[model samples]
Target chain A: MKAVLGNMRAELVGAGGVVERNAYLTKRYIWWDVAWFVWTVANTLTIVFIAKGIEATGGSLDVNETMTTLLIGAVVWAYLGILFEFLMETVAWERWEGTIEYTFMAPLSRAMHLAGQGVFAIAYGLVRAIFLFCVCAFVFFSLSIPDAKYFPAFVVLVVASISFIGIGMMMSVLPLISPEKGTQLGFVAQGTLLVVSGVYYPVSVLPEWMQWIAKVSPATYALDGIRKAILEGQGLSALWSDLWPLLLIGFVSIPLGLWVFQRGEQYAKRHGKLKRSG
Target chain B: MTNIQQAAIEALPRRTAPAVDVRDLSKEFRRRDRKLGRFAHRKRVALDGVSFTMQRGETVAILGQNGSGKSTLVRLLSTLLLPDGGSAEIFGHDVVRDARAVRRLVNRVSVEASFFKKMSSSENLGYASRYYGMTSRQTRDLIPQILGRVGFPPDRRDEPMESLSRGMQQKVALARALLTSPVVLLLDEPTTGLDPRSKLEVQEFIREIRSSHDSTILLCTHDLAEAETLAERVGILDRGQLLAVEPADALRRRFGATTLEEAFFAATGRAFEADDEEDDEDREVFA
Candidate 1:
């Protein structure tokens, strides 16, 4: 028991140290920051202009309503962007940079190393999410107070993002296994999630079976939960229905993601893919 | 903390074990052809009946061109990939059975190192150091010193990794591998694509580490000169076969050739520069 505790302590210490280092490294790359800046400016300007036109010419629409709707749309879009970024920008980027082999060679488990990489991506997500939220609130919602339900909404958003990121990481590992075939599967998965998540519209509009699919979709949990809290002024009690599902999705996806990633790594090694690439 | 004190501590006898061992180890991969249907796929032999052993502190160079299973051998021994046919042991610990133990003893550095492209060299190295269990202060102080020894430009330490030249990036990789200084060092074409000066600097660092520290080095490379300089014994690997292992001079004399290049041709019936056609779709195994 003592040995186990010592080892765990060592691992935790190692993980903490690594996080600091990665955070420092993340600051050097303007890539994520620049990407967020461009996305925010583009979305902000478009939403403001569109809302302006909607408010013009004696439409009965409240200025607050138009602005809030635009804000909700922007936030949802940014959240979706975060999901795909995990796949293309973080996991896939590892392969393109030829660091996959290096990670395989490191002292820590591949899972932990990937976790470290995943943290950097979460940083990117947080930056974009907060920026969008702030801009929308200040310009459109009069810096409106968050509903009591916002805490639950934020929790659901985090849970959904965590689950989706795992899925994205799993898909990223596929390209390493079979470049051509794995990539095709990745595209299909990405497109399917996008269509099913109800990012741009409400899932209630979908057909019955499709609505079920959206209910279980990670994006659906995040988008719907946030839209309810921020736009509809829903409270925490209102989101209780979606809470357990988000937790279940997160619990199941994390393990599955690790298992699939490890399996893919073993397959590549057994087959001598490294040598072929060399 | 001091050099002499550390050496004395390192010298205290504890255990004697072969740093690495392998028996009948083989790995095969399946590759599908998209031009054809799903069933129109095939299996390729990556490491076929590969077997070898390395004693502590001995440096061995496996010289092979692309697709000769050099990196595959390194990966299996390091526990990055499991063998399909046989077993491998590191320090008497099975790579598969005692993988966690094996992982603690080995560190691998490859030519194509991946870094957060937006991060600077120091930041990347610090991250690797932290992952290996270094504290913040140690990483902060140690990374710059190590990078300096490897000839990394001070000014470029804070620039994004993508902005650096390949040669400079390769130097940073060598620095990262040395950060933890594991018991076994596996370098997969470590100097490939490096500029002449950077290559020499890295080679010198490897030599320094081997002599100053108790490390068993396994280097896979296509550079004959590197094989001669860094390894005490060189193994010629061709078509997943280890044709011979001996000192460079011995290998030349055995083949009745005066140079490593000539001996390679005599042994493999081809030039060192010959292009290989074999491709394995087994990368998913590593994913």
Candidate 2:
């Protein structure tokens, strides 16, 4: 029992150290962080403005209602975007810094290292998403959800992050084995999720095949739950339909992600791809 | 306290164990056989049944040209790469099965030693120390002291690693390896690309490390003089095979050559200066 406790304590300390190191790196590359922030804000604005543009051009739609829906989509998309970027770029950043070998060779288990990254990504992504949401809300003053149950919406978003992190963990292996196209492929994976998850349009509007894809995506439920909680002011009991799926996916994905990454790591070592840089 | 002193204080009870032991170790890499109609594959042997052992506190150097599997051996022993066949142990801990234990015991310094480029030398060392489970209190004073001992200029310790010269970066690498006071140090051409003065300084530091600590060193290098100067045993590895491992004078006498370079030629039937870069072109690609 004492030995197990000691081991657990070591793992926690090791994971914390990885988080601390990443925080230092983030501080060192403050410009990249700033640039990403600006890009996300611009991206959110671009989508939200389309609704405004429709209003300006005298479209037949209900302008205020349409704008509010678009604002929700924009805010949700911004949150998911940061989440995906943080998770997917985990290995790419290590490669860029040339610390992949050292990091891998450290005594810490793979579980601890990746869990550290996942935790950092979620924390950092939440902060960035909140900032983007605030800035967008300020710019689009008329964007308001009539009954905003923010607590449940926030819970859904947090739950959704677990699945996204698992997916990100899986994607990180792409770079570990193939330094050339792994990172680009990660973004491609994110783009596919975006198209299917109804980040802008309702899932019903998507093609039948895309709706099927969305059925498996935790982000789909996340978006649906958040929209209901905010747009309809639904309580936790009302959001159970979306919550269960998110929970299931989160439980499944974290372990699957870790397994896939471990296999990729072993394959990379065998093929001498771990330290290969283009 | 200096790392040497710290190592002694925290040292585990010594046993009658060799620092490293290997038996019939082999590694094969698959490469694309472009010459065989572009889709064919072949196995390129990196290490072929290589076997050796090092007693504790001994310094052994493996001399090999590029592509001669020095790095592969280091990677295998360091538990970064698993062997295709055979087994290796660090102080009785199997490298593959007990990788975590082996990792705690061995530290590697390579020419390709990587750092968080955005972080300063001190930060990099601090990160490594923490990973090795060093407390903040120990690292606060120990990191700068280690850097200083490695001949890194105190003023330059805080500069971004990207801005530092390769020589300075190599110093930081050495400092990181020493930070944990590893029992086995695997050096894979640690001074390959440094200037002569920097190379000498690193070599001197390696000598000091051997003398000051109860650590075994395995240095892999192409520099013949370096192998002769620092290591008690100089090994000649050629084309994935270890030809001989002996003292420099014994190697020269066994090959009936006047110098270590000639001894290398006598054993390998190739000039020591020959470029082996083209050898990689025929490697087998694993799908």
DockQ winner among the candidates? 2
Q: Give the per-residue lDDT of model 1 (tens digit) for A152-265.
A: 657767767677767867876776676546656766776677567765556777788888887767767777777777767787678766666777887888788878887876
In terms of lDDT, model 1 sits at: 0.71
Model 2 iRMS = 2.0
Candidate 1 lDDT tens digits, B1-287:
22422432354233575777877888765666776786787666667787788888899998877777887788787776777888888777788877766766677887676677877887777766665556667667777887897788888898888888888888888877777767778998998988898788889988988888777899999999999999999989876777888889999999999999998999988899876443422432321
lDDT of 2 by residue, A1-278 (tens): 98588667767777777777878888998898899788877777788778778878987776665655666677767676666666656677777777767777778888888888888888887888667766777565556666788889888888889899888888888887778878788778777887898887889999899999999998799888988887789999999999999989999999999999999888978877765442
List CA RMSD, all candidates.
4.7, 2.8
The list of candidate 1 runs beyond 4 A from truth reads: A13-26, A40-70, A140-152, A178-191, A194-200, A231-234, A271-278, B1-16, B29-39, B42-44, B113-118, B151-156, B159-168, B193-196, B249-263, B271-287
Give the clashing residue pairs of candidate 2, or none.
Answer: B30-B284, B30-B285, B31-B283, B31-B284, B31-B285, B32-B284, B32-B285
DockQ of each: 0.40, 0.54
State each model's CA lDDT, in order: 0.71, 0.82
Question: Which candidate number would show the highest TM-score if scored against the true structure?
Answer: 2
The residue-level lDDT of candidate 2 at B237 comes to: 89
Off by over 4 Å in 2: A57-60, A140-142, B1-14, B280-287
Model 2, range B1-287, lDDT digits (tens) per residue? 35543543354334665788888999988766788767887678988989899998899999987778888899888777879999999888898898887887788898865888879988888766666666667788888888999999999988999899898899999999988888889998999989999999999999999898888999999999999999999999887888988999999999999999999999999888886555643331211
